[model samples]
Target: MNNVRSKICGITRVEDALAAARAGADAIGLVFYAKSPRAVNVQQARAIVQALPPFVTTVGLFVDASRCEVGEILDALPLDLLQFHGDETPAQCEGHGRPWIKALRVRPGDDLEAACQEYVGARALLLDAYVAGVPGGTGQSFDWSLIPARLSKPVVLAGGLSPDNVAEAIAQVKPWAVDVSGGVEQAKGIKDAQKIDAFLRAVRGA
Candidate 1:
């Protein structure tokens, strides 16, 4: 089998996006949710996307954003994929006519398998830890065992992942990809270059 891919989300700066691409991140995510401290304006995100090297995927993240909001950003910036991190239905997600990854917050006793089935046609299913009063960007990990081995779609593990434990997470869960936000950040929306390099190295080693 091939090595697990990883994404560095909540990117806010051109330097950070460059660092993430250089560090071998499969994709770099830019938050567009206005409520998020990590959110970036279209111009800022477009600059960062344009600055990246070829083949480095740029991902746009939204939290129940309106169609107009998503359309406006897509029209302005170059994005390879869209990630829906809120209570968006499959129809709403697919209506945009862009490939998308749907994030599902997993909690104890939750049926991950069934949830994946519910979001049919998603490019990938991102499994994030369930935290009270937190929508996303909470660097907390859920039980790997909570995920069933059998699923209809690809699984992308998110929540709390870092250089130290990513290898273990990969070995155990065998997810198609892993995503990190706060784990590689200097602040809520800022990414650390050293941490980004280390995290990518760890994923490669796994």
Candidate 2:
């Protein structure tokens, strides 16, 4: 079994996907929201997804997108999982037949347990730091104490994770997996290959 799984999100180019996969990423994310600067058109996403090597899961992220939009993207790109970053109801998240992961924007004084309870059927819960008026991809982390010791589903930690501190974060949280976007990028929508390799090596060591 993979010891410390890692996901590289917001991939926009073929080279980036290949770099992430070579760096040992367990999965890679493709942003489908048109509003996001990192967002990829259906054709672009399809090409990138097709170029990815075997054994690397592709995750499609949406922010309050309609079922039809999600379906079309899924048909276009062979994504392995769906991630809801906006305020999507459980009904909406489950409406798609594919397994889904829900993003919980961690905020001060937030009840992590209660939030996870709302999405009980989610394949996994991704805990990310809350950013006003932004649909994630923010290089900020929340307080780890907010996460409860016992959760019903797997927890995939995200937000501000980098090679510098990923080991400490994993040792403390012990999440089923960890995800990174801006942390491994040189700038928004641009990935740094060396950073990707370093981040993966750190997670592998954990």
Candidate 3:
């Protein structure tokens, strides 16, 4: 089987970031949105990034934050990628001098292809479950059938992904990558090493 990349999101500590890397995660996401329970400050994010081993990508996740706020975090850390989890315009996502992925919360009757076209500059489109007033990390699964078989850009499957269900999700979606946050967590922001290992194993086995 071909390799499907994995990303462990909502990492708050250096220990968890290192754990994700050890568990063979391709990337570790640091939540920068203040509303999220897993959100991290600049110091915490920097510490996690510094502790990660070689070849593990560091991603900074933001909500609908201002350009200045995003710039401040970018200036402080050596993040490999930026993940915008809110309603950000294409222009805002671009001109940042770093690659970015835009997250779209999937809802019934939504035209994903058209939305993808609007955000044509994104490196990939991350599909998550849509909850009223909730940004992301909802730990809820949406209808996988809503995704089109072909997309102009790559897809990163997320939302309610755990060791038990990830294999099935991979078979169904066949996304370029899979991102998990609450799925491998001991609690809101704390990562469970055992869960992380099991999740990776499931993905690789699939």
Candidate 4:
């Protein structure tokens, strides 16, 4: 089986971040959007980032945030990657001096190839479920069949992923990586250790 990387997103505490790293997650996401229940302040994010051991990627997630806000967070945190989860223009995603990925909420009749082409400079594209007025962390699955068999860039599958269904998701999507937030959470912003472990095991088993 191909190694499918796992990212534990919506990290708010140092302990949770450490737990994820200890569980062998490839990356941990820190939510920067204030509206998100998992959102963290600069101090929280900084502490979590500092607590992490070497080689574990730290990703900062934002939703339609201004350049100034993003810059401020970048100055405070040593995020390894940026994940834009809003309707950000391709040009807006560039020139940040950091590799970034654009998240697209998949819906029926959506032309994914064209969308990927628009964000050609992205390091990868993350696919998530679309809910009215909800940005992400919806914990709702989309139609996996909506994804194309081929793409110009790598794909990171997200949305409604848990240990139970992650193996099936991997089999179908064959994404480069899988991102999960609410799936392993005991509540909003609180991660469950057993769930995290099971999620990793499922990815490996797949």
Against the true structure, what is each candidate's TM-score?
0.96, 0.96, 0.99, 0.99
What is the descending lDDT order? 4, 3, 2, 1
Task: For residue 140, give model 4's deviation from the true position in Å.
Answer: 0.2
**lDDT of every predicted structure (CA atoms):** 0.89, 0.90, 0.94, 0.94
Clashing pairs in 2: none
lDDT of 4 by residue, 1-206 (tens): 56999999999988889889999999999999999999999999999999899999999999999999999999888899999999999988887879999999999999999988899999999999999899999999999999999988899999999999999999999999999999999999999989999999999999
Q: After superposition, how far is residue 7 of candidate 1 from its true place, in Å?
A: 0.5
Candidate 1, residues 1-206, lDDT tens digits: the string is 35788899999999999999988999999999888889999889988988999988888999888889889888888788999999998877887767999998898888767877788878889999998767799899989999888787899999899889988999998999999999998888888999999998888888
Return whichever of 1 and 3 wins on TM-score: 3
Indicate the residue-level lDDT of 173 in model 1.
Answer: 88
RMSD of each: 1.2, 1.4, 0.7, 0.7
The 10-residue segment of model 2 with minimum total lDDT is: 107-116
lDDT of 2 by residue, 130-187 (tens): 8899879889988887888888788999989998988989988999999999999988
Clashing pairs in 3: none
lDDT of 1 at 178: 95
